[model samples]
Target: MAIPRLRPLLLVAVLLLRAFASLPTQAAARGGLDPSPGIADRKHGSSSRSLLQDQPEITEEMVRGYMSNFELESAIQDFGRRCANISRTYSIGKSVNGSPLWAIEISDKPGQREAEPAFKFIGNVHGDEPVGREVLMQLAYWLCDNYLKDPLAALIVENTHLHILPSMNPDGFALRRRGNANNVDLNRDFPDQFFPNNDDIKHRQPETRAIMNWIKQEHFTASASLHGGALVANYPWDGSRDTRKQYYGCPDDKTFRYMASLYSQSHYNMSLSKEFEGGITNGALWYPIYGGMQDWNYIHGGCFELTLEISDVKWPKASELLVIWKQNKMSMLNLVASLVKTGVHGRIFAADTGRPIPGSLMVKGIDSKINASGSFGDYHRILAPGQSYEVVASMEGYRPKRTRVMLGREATNLDFILDPDGAVRRTKPLRNDCGCSCNDNSNTGKPFLLREAYLWLYLLALFFLLALYLLFRRRMALRLAAHRHPPPKRPVAV
Candidate 1:
């Protein structure tokens, strides 16, 4: 009996050691193991050999149809020339390997600042996920080819400024790896809300720094980053305070849910997914991830962002890209259209000066605050429709204004005109140039003036009587003169 028990205990210890050995040491440093279903935990030191052995080798025939980094850049430049009237191409920054991170801006006014809301679509955040970059180029070509012919395309181009960054990790894509040339996960390099590990900007990767700076430069109202290995529209808060795997919603939980559903319900079959209900999920619920770009966007950039897992396979055949694009076309269009179709957009102004004021906008019960554009004082606040909200606009030197609005299915325009604090005292009194005493000051008359008022009244009465007598005498004299003058006028007529 003792020998059997010892043998069982030894076998259990051996199994435990093997299990521990399988987990890489870096897993603990990246905020414990990721429990997200269906997603390979490549960030946590998943073995490259095992990953490579699992997937079929990518042959030359496999990549023949796909655009390389060089081809993608050339295609973007060609698109810029082809659709120069409505679109322009520019590079935000270069990757660590000196690959230009190109961005195609599509709008009626490409580089000009307008009062309209801006939306950005970032693709290929991970190098191994090359589907996004291809799909993005297709999206650009589709919009360019069907602007006036398609009503939805016309609406997007006319109403909103759309920016597309095809591949954010060109170096990683070139190296045929998940991370950049530095081997750092771009998605996990953002400043985490709950963790201090990635808070230092100096240690951030170059791509992460470029994105952060780009957000600061452009006031994007909403954005989305594309990824692969699953089909779900993921919204924030991506990480939790305790780092536990649970459902964590951000401040704009309802609006984000509506946004996610808009993308999923419009998709061909994303809503039919058995894994994700409606092909949408809260990031933390799926699995808590620290230093994610989605949560950081909401917390720091004030941009409502979604991390979209667009494909089930990270590297699908190049020929299948068009089918994938077709499946996601409506979803992408609807997601961008939601910005114009379902938000409160307006400008704040000073009442006295009638000039725009860069004030802060806040909802009564909501914890978040969206600031107006510095130049135009314009703001686009995304909220769930069919509800009433107490919207407040505030400025430092101006009196805050609040309005009760009942938002319906359509977008609402609510502009606030704030009055300067203590404006009433500075107001000028109206002038009475007619010389009439409209205001009565008799109650506050001087003490001596009150006593002398009767004497002055009597003197005024005597003078008035004398003047009446004089007027009567003069009228009697004038009547006699008129009687004499009338007879002469009759003779002149004859």
Candidate 2:
């Protein structure tokens, strides 16, 4: 019995050794760790030849003209000093290696919160693709130099709050690789709606976490990331369910196409692409990817983001960088201007109290919803120009409002002052799917009962303060009485 068992064990060991011997070195070591899907698969030689493939070895001469990490930071600080009136420099967070992630915000009122729509341009999402970082610096300086003289630049600067994050992955840039210092791709590090690979927040990269926090804090209306290795404007639905490479679109698919077309059409020759029709392609359609920043922005950040591949070469000769900027200049300007030039923008308020309310907005027939800013009750909805749309505004405890508008080439202004729920006053207030606190009465479905109001909030705060004051005064009077009028019978016990 012991000899028979030994024979079977020897046979199993032989098969295991053969299997391990036949595996590719990279694949064997990886062991399905990072799929490194999407962009890495495009035209590269090698996890991520996907985004920035076909580039020569990253030699010092290759990156000679490109700004070093120190030079990039100096340029940022210089921009803040030179354009001090219209720009402010700040750090969002740090990279894994403690590289300061610097950002420049440019507007008529920099560093101040306003009701204007905010648009951000994130460059160098892939450290190896440094074209974006340089181009973004160009964009910032252009707006600074031409704020009043150029009409398009002026429109963007005055009507919108523009933010520029020159490089999102500095460590990756320094390493001359696609991923960060930890070798994780920043683009694929975001949380994916289709998969749970990045659901563990504790394991997210520092750069990715910084971006997520910034999105929630600033609440940008629209944004775009720059890339290379191809020349096309890529929109959302980056990855499809079942991991299939096909066209899967988000609810705002039409709006996204229109926005992408603006960038492509404005480019010097991007719209004339032979590969991408009209120089624009849906992300999933072009190449399906998981945990892409574009899709995550739309789903979680309420930001309409586009992944723009502006160059055919990843790390082109630094001499070619200016031409790249000049080619994409109009496209960038047009996209930012579109926020104020064409779209639906306004504030929401409670009808009775006349204060801003956190009302949610949705377009008829579109599945996605836009949440108005809690600070100003402000929302911006981008749509195709020269089209008709049915827009609806609703909040818990408030009567919903809907309207039809024929949107023109210029941006439209629409404000909704919703009345509190009154139809069913017998029910309780509850939170709705839109993250709004709604008071719902069960008696025949009534609306409006004051769940999210600045006026009610102020009043409740005042009432609590008054009650606190009275309680404190009453206690003081009792203390004084006890000190002045002591009981006489207690002395005998002592």
Candidate 3:
């Protein structure tokens, strides 16, 4: 039976309704995602919104006016030549029509070279969602152009290795189609290795192959794929159901929630109360999507993946591109910065046996908080410093843990071995219960992990190696091809 096709506008509206309804419950219970600390109750008036909502509409005319064929090619080439240090090129496999699948790497540190965690900002996975391409391009340009002028830009590029494949489905991009040239949905092609894919079987597309290959080759810390026509950020590892029945959570669901909430706070203005006004966990803005880029990245790639629907429609007007960019730019910056900050470092184990506890922990300080380390023995929290703070650590079959730590000149490392009696211990909920301590933001936050000086040196080394490789290989390949062509017969025939 043929599936009924819906109009683009209707489909998007429906998707939004379904997504909004599916926002996870804010209950701090089993299989529920909770909101982090420092989540403001009210919007930051107009200034905050104005800063993010800079780009209003992206019309087709606007896209065509600035983003021409020549400009697209030039952007790709310029990225290859100018930003050679922070990135490398790879094949995404092939397209349906047999084209070279190209992906650009944007790592602050190399694969062999160890540093902070890595991330990939993939765009145009659906081909027609072209707004992501613009976002990625603008981000890269800003990073390169303001490497020295902007401290934040330089900080992000220096500490983080950001891999970006701005356009994943060039064939569909060329055709202006949502699906690939083969008419298959590229977003629905990821194979579920950890859990079985419960939806319709539509695996094994070329674009999927390329992404899978890249992910398998280089393990990233987190990733976000850009989509258009939706004004929400989706995170996960589920098959359209964000519950225990379909997709409960990732091993690092707590961390995913922390990061996703950060993006939401910085951009979407979505509070816990309004997060689920659309749906439960199935067909809403906050629902889980199975066989999705985010899910696959979380389960298979071991990286946190988020599906960022930039606009309110699948095909927003090109004029809205810049507006979406403004909305997303800072959120993206915050996410990268948080990932590199290397939050509160501590140890978690059994108080009785001093055995390590393998589970999740949450630590809250001032206006920022962090999810502790994935490794149970030792944990780290990424935080924004200043003010007296509190911490909480909990895992299944153990009593919840809470304490306070002060941030100052040194990295705060607290060691906790849970009591054997903690399994049955009942604890009271600790809030900012008192106004006793002083609240001050006088001191600026510090980088907990990779320092700026070391980060720049690493980025410098990465670009230097990339330059030598490209120069030497291009020269060799050109010479070999020239030898085979016999100097083009000296153009004598003309």
Best model number under TM-score: 2
RMSD of each: 25.9, 20.4, 26.0
lDDT of 2 by residue, 358-409 (tens): 7888888889998988877888889887888877888988887656667877
- Candidate 2: list runs displaced more than 4 Å: 1-55, 423-494
lDDT of 1 by residue, 1-494 (tens): 12343454456545544543332111000004333322333433331213223555556776668789999999999999999999999999999988999999999999998778889999989888888999999999999999989998998998889999999999998877788999988888887767664656888899999899899999999999988778889999877776656788888999999999999999889899997898899987776667778888888888999999888887888888999999999999988988888767777766555567789888888899988888777889999888888778899997776656677777776666566776542211111111111111122211111113334654565566556656666777788887778764355664
User: What clash pairs does model 1 have?
Assistant: none
Better of 2 and 3 by TM-score: 2
RMSD of 2: 20.4
Looking at candidate 1, the ten consecutive residues that score lowest on lDDT are: 22-31
Between candidates 1 and 3, name the one with more favorable TM-score: 1
lDDT against the true structure, per candidate, is 0.77, 0.80, 0.55
- Residue 161 CA error for candidate 3 (Å)? 0.7
What TM-score does each of the candidates earn?
0.76, 0.77, 0.55
